[model samples]
Structure formats: C-alpha cells, structure tokens
Target: MADLTIRNLTITPLELVSVERFQGEKKRTGNVVSNVTGAITGFINATDFSAHHILPKGDSHDSRDVSFHLDPFRTVRTDVRSADPAGREVLRLTFRAGDRRYETDVPSPSRKSSVMKRIDGDDDVDDALDLTVVYVPTGAFLAIFSSAKLYAWMKQLDDAWPLPLLSIPGTHNSPTCHTALPSVRCQSVGVPEQLQNGVRFLDIRVSVNTDNDTLALVHSVFPVSLTSIKYFSDMVDDIYRFLDANPSETVLMSIKREGAGRGTDQHLSRYLKAGFVDKNADRWWTEPRIPTLGQARGRIIIVRRFGLDEEMARSCWDGRGWGIDGQHWPDNCEDGTCEGGHIRVQDFYDVTESQNIEKKIDYSRGQLERSAEREFHVIGPEHDHNPDPALLPIFVNFLSGSNFFNATCWPERIAAKVNPAIVEYLCIRHGEDGKGPNQLKVGAASTGIVVTDWVGANGDWDLIRCIVGWNARLQLP
Candidate 1:
C-alpha cells in the first residue's frame, strides 16, 4: 500500500471486482489495486508513467462501467519525483470496464495542490469519512475529495425529499462579500465558492438603476466593494456556472429589492424576468410551492422577496403564484412567518452592542431547535420515512446581525461569535457527528436553512460543514 487506495477514502464495505486498464483496442483487466473493494481500493502501484506502455496519442480507454479518471495524465506529482525521458515522474492510471474509458492523474492536474495533501504515501487520516456522499469530478470515484469535501451533500439525499425539510447551508449577502467595508460587506467568499462549499441558500439584495435599468448588488445602502460596484448579473452568472457544473445540487436564492438606486420592487421583478429568467427559463423553478429534490435539481428555486409586476403575475408562473412569496416578511422578525405562512424566520438583527451577540446566538439556537424538534419525530417508521409536506415548515434562521458604531457588532465581527457558537451547539445537540445517537432520541433532527456571514474565515468552514452534516438525518434507511 504505497500509493492511492480505496481504503484511504471510505469505511463503506465495497465488493471486490477487477479494475481494467485499456487504450483503443489494447485492453488490460486485472487487480490493479491489490485489495477487497471494487474501486481503486487497497494499494495501487504508483510507478513512472512510461512503464505503463500508454498509447502514442496519450488518449486512453473509456470504462463504460463506472467510469473515472486515470492517474498521472500529463503532469508531475509533488509526492513522486522520478526521472523519465521527459524528466517527469508522473503516476498514470488508466481504468477501463465494458465499453467505457476514463483516465487522469492520481492527484488530478485539474485539481488544486490542496487536494494533493490527501495522498502522502498512503496516510488515510483525513476528512473522507466526514463526507456525507462526496465525489470528485476529477476522479468521480468515492467520498475522497481534494479541497473541501462538501461540494455535493445533496447527491446522497433521496430525490423525493422536499425542499423544506432538507438541512441546507446558506450565506447572507452572498455575492456582496469581497472584503471591503465592515458595515456593508457580509461575506468573504463570492457566490461560486459558497455553492462549491455546500451552501444551498443565497441571501441577495439588488439595487435597480432605473435610469439605465441595470442592477447592482447591495447590502443595506452601501455597495459591496468600496473601489468597484458588483452587479446583479455577476451574482446570477456565478449561480449559473455552479449549477451547470453540479446539477445534482440546487440553490434557494432569496432575492429582494433594496440598495442605493432608484429601482422599485416592481422594476426589480420585470428586470429579473426579462433579463435573466425569461431567456434561460429552464434554469429556474418559479413556482411558490416547495419542490422535491427531483424537481429542483439543475435549477434555481426562486425565493422572491418582492412581488411580481401586476401584469406578469397573471401571465407568468402558469398562474401557480410567483416564487415562495416572502414579500410581506417584516424586518427583524423573531420566529416570524410570511403572509402565506410557508416560511418561518429568526432574523433578530437588532444587536445594538457587542454583549447582545450572546442574545443573537441564543435566538439562532432556539430556531434550530424548533426546526429540528418539529420534523424529527415524524420521519420515523410511523410516517414511512416520507413525512407529509404540510407538517414541515421552511425554517430560515439568520446568524447574521450588525450595528453601525459598535465595532464588535459589525458583520464580520458578529459572524466570529455567531458561526462558531452555532457549530458547537449543533454538535452537542446532534451528538457525536452521526445520526445514530440523536436519531434514537429525536428521529434524525434537522436545522433547515441556516444563513450566516464571513465563511471560510481562516480556512474554517466548520459551520457550513456542520449544517450540511445534519442532512444525514434525511439519508437514513
């Protein structure tokens, strides 16, 4: 076991099978990795690329059965340093099964160097076990991820699970975060990074420049960046790209009309329809009712905070009502409900001072408890594990709060306190990072959609990881 192995990735019991390597008509099928589990389990012979006798074209076989990338495609490995004719010691792995073929480097050249850390001469002490159901796009093998293993939590979930019941991580002012003003900027990462890290909900506020019908992202009255203005389409494009790549995942985008522009809520609605929604209609689900995972995959579930323009309401959404209407949602609501009562929130943002941060933390924990308590018991054998949608409410708990003068109560400052606190609370409440302990008492609890700010603060996405970890409750047999 000197190189890549499946045991290094997961504890799941895998059936042993032959791993074949091939190119064109030239095919070789044998136990490449000497171990028991179907994937590249046990130990893979990490050797120089030239020894493998690859084709002159460098193109390999397409393993029709369970296709994945081959190791040592065209780059040198940081770990393996050897001298070939090209002076590169690349570990090349070519796997072929049935009529299919796939091959790439073990530490994929396409992936960043951070993923390379996992392969240090067969030390499997890593986060592969933490993954709910992680898979690498570069390898598509198992739960072993390169960067952050949370790229796809929803993929493990049952497609029939309704949107309201799933435990989803989200960001407040997602796109606005670029590290500028503390009062306005609410996040550190852009929309794409947030989605890639398993954030499924996005809190968005847009300013409509009615003068030119252009949209700019805003947090309260201040622009996200002090030097430049970030536009609304920029955020939309980020979401578009993320969904395009990870179609198995979905985003519940909460769009509201607010900012330092002359744009009205009416103008905001029309612009979204004419500019983005209408053009790429397939990318969005505009209906008000909650959707099952099957229906929302590869699409954006619009949580419209503004009502549609009067005329479009009758013509659009197939008269199905426009988005999950949260238009009447009042400000700073504590365990508040929208007009239709489809949404429940705990957005107590009035933290005038730093000491009140504890109060804010308490409010957030209360909401998570409420959301978990209601849905946990019903999903047992009594409900056939398919609880009624009516019994489930969409819980939106905000760990975001701020103050103008209080330096400690600023957005980033507040997240420092709130984010870590919630992570600690959930771990204890849920117990030992697995479903068995909590599931026994509460039948697999859920925290619903949790919104926060300043994620990835010092490479710590624990809060997001914890929020996503709760989805294990829904993944039970």
Candidate 2:
C-alpha cells in the first residue's frame, strides 16, 4: 500500500527512476526490485507493477528528474510537491511507460489505502487524474487517479484572457445523464459531477409547455430522463452550486430549443428571462459578445442557441441584454462562421454507421488544427495595454454524432471510438517530448472550446486533462 503502482498500457518494458534526492533512511546498491517491465515468470511477464515509494510525511517540496530507460533515454525535470494548491496532501509524479511521458498530481491516499485500489474499486471515484499525456518516441501510458482538478482548473488563467483563447473542456449534451434510450442520453455523469471533473461548458436543450409556462430539459422530442423529467430551473441551480464553490471558474451555457415545446424559441427565451435573468441578474451574463475570464468568473456565460426575441431585446440591462448571438446557425455546418465572425463552429453530427465514426473524428481533428493556427488575441501582463481589442473568432468544435435509425451510432458508442482517437492525436501532434513542431508552441496555439460527450467514462479523463494542460502554454513564457 505504501508503493505507487504503474499500469503500463503498452507492451514495452520501461524503467522509472529518480535522479536527485537527499540521502535517505533506505539503502540500495542496485534496482534489484523490478517494479514495472519485470518478468513475472519464465513464461509470463507483468505489464503493471509497483514502485517502492512512500509519501512524504510533511508537505515538503523536492525537485527531481524522472528518467525512462526507453529508447533514446529521456529525463523529465519536475517539482515533486507533497501537496496541491488546495493544501490537500498529494503525491506529485512524473514518469514514462508506454509511448508517452506523464506528469500527474495524485492525492496521497490513507495509510491503509493503495493508489491502484482506489482507482479499480469502490472508493472515492470522483477524483480526476490531472494527467498530461505526452507522446515519446516509444512507450504509451502510466495511469494515476488523483485530485479534483476540474473543480478549479481555471484559477490559473489570467483575468484578462479571452474565452476564445482558453482551451475549455465542455460536454455536448451536459445534462442528459439518466436512464433513457441510447440516442437520448449523451452523458453518464450528472451536471454537478461533470463540472467537478473539469467540464466548463454545458450544452442544454429546453422545451416550453404553454399549459403551465414550464421548461423541460429534453433531447429532441424525448425528455432527458424517461423515469424522472428534469426541468431547466433545476439545472441552473446545479450551475449555481458549482460556481459558488469554485469562484475561480465560469460556466458557458449553450441553450437551444428542442423537445415537443408548445411554444417557439421566443417563448423559451422569455421563460429564461423570467426564470434566471430578471430574478438573478448577478449570476448571468447575457451579453451578445464574448467576455474575458475576469468578467465572467462565478457567472454563467450564455451562448444563446435559441433566437433573441424582439420584445426582449429592449429589456437588456445594457441595451443589448441577449447572450452570445447564435441564432440560426446552419445545421451540419463544417468550418462555418456566424454572428458577424464572432464564433466559428463545426457541428457535423451525422455519422450514420459505427464504421463512419472515423469521418467525424477527421472533421473534429481538422477543427482542432484550425484553432491551433489561429491568430490569437490575449490580454495579459505584457507590452499590450489595450484592454479590449477587436475580437477574434472562437472555435466551437463538436465531436458528437448519432444516427437516428442506427443504434450502433449512439452517443456513448461513438464517443468510445472518437474520444480515445482524439486523445492519441493530441498527444502525438502536441507531445512536448522533444519532437520538433509536434508540440503546441508556448503562449501561441489554442484549441479553443472542445464540446464532447461521455467524458470521465470508466475512469478516463485524458482528453479533459490534455485540453486543460494546453492552457499552460498561455501561462508559460
């Protein structure tokens, strides 16, 4: 239980070592103990093994280089912190196993606990492995399940930074987490859990019932949950709780009109105004333009997927009170721009069969590549002084697809194939593993906001971690 385990995801034999440390109580002449890549028996070999590491009793800071014996020996210098920013005792790690090098923050488990046991068993399961997957020339992954990094990942961002330049992790259908048909439910985790796991954007669909003037959370014509119907007001309450607890974070809302609503998008808009905007103006930002992180912290940045009603236009607090104008976005558009070039979207969700998921992945990757090459506009402490400049378009890429007739093309099924491939693509293309031009240029390239589905499924948050890690590029020189 004192040792940290390595779950090697590759077939190669890898060795992890520390190159710097003070003389310790333990004695060692050689690495007689082969934790990972050691032969189990004459006929069998063990893929996952444990390294003899005991957590420091105190929150002391140590610097060490994690070396891998894989081909072309690579050493990663990292600070070994005994605790994270929240003052929670943690075990910071850096090592390599498969075709990737990982830097992780693992919460120090109880003396009677094992890191691998918590990951594979009925323990605290909401903890995210704040893992950065960097592809090396050889070898893939060494897994770790750690702290709730998604709770406050944006605290590191500059207050002046634009939302478009930040690599925000979002869900395709943020609140569709319930017992329903495969096509109706897009997520397994609920709204609050999604935000805890580092998802910042929520894609919501609401239908208005004229009978009682209530809004129902829905996906197409069906309710989000067949057993229990969810209302739009309750979902907003969930956002309130998360943002109140993590004041450093903000939530972007993409609200569209769907389901069997007896009213039009205008009715839906009025219902939102009466329910959230007028009563709790402090928690909502209904501007038609993008705002900096400083302007939106602890607030919901609304991206109006529904049209702005003419009557409500005059009700603006600032004479333009509607949210980010996203009315009439062309369906199934690839690399399309709208609202006078403020937002660019790729929402091609038409993967008819399971085999055609590759096509959707290609389109999604293309959008990421486009966002990477953006002429970015950021406001930080530097030579730049103009607080607000002409806005640059933000890329909102949707890697979500489904076939109405084909059960094989449901959200979860498609995500199983697409998310891993996208994660691999990001690692390979932006590895930071000494591969020239295969990395995101620090403080330059941005992935914008990536809307996905089924995140944190079966203990996998590599995609979220990669997206959040890229924000480090903005922080670094």
Best by TM-score: 2
Where does model 1 exceed 4 Å of error?
Answer: 1-148, 376-391, 431-443
Worst 10 residues of 2 by lDDT: 41-50
Candidate 2 per-residue C-alpha lDDT over 1-477 given as tens digits, one digit per residue, 9 for 90 to 100: 223333332223344543222221212222655532233421121112233333445443455665545322122223332233232344445444343333333432221112322122334435323333232211222332222366898886788777887888899988888888878878868889889889998899888777565888999999999898898888888889988899999999999988887888778788888878889998988877888888989999888877766788776756664888778675887688876567899898988888788888887877777777654444455625235532777789898998878877888778877877777555445323323233333224577789998886534566787677666555433
* lDDT, model 1, position 256: 87
What shift in Å separates residue 433 of candidate 1 from its native position after superposition?
15
lDDT of each: 0.63, 0.65
RMSD of each predicted structure: 14.6, 11.8
What value of lDDT does candidate 2 attain over all alpha carbons?
A: 0.65
Clashing pairs in 2: 98-139, 98-140, 99-139, 99-140
Model 2 misplaced regions, further than 4 Å: 1-148, 315-321, 376-390, 431-443
TM-score to true structure, per model:
0.67, 0.71
Which tens-of-lDDT digit does each residue in 61-141 have in candidate 1?
332233233231111112222112221223333333222222334332222112222222335453232222121222122
- Supply candidate 2's per-residue lDDT for 331: 85
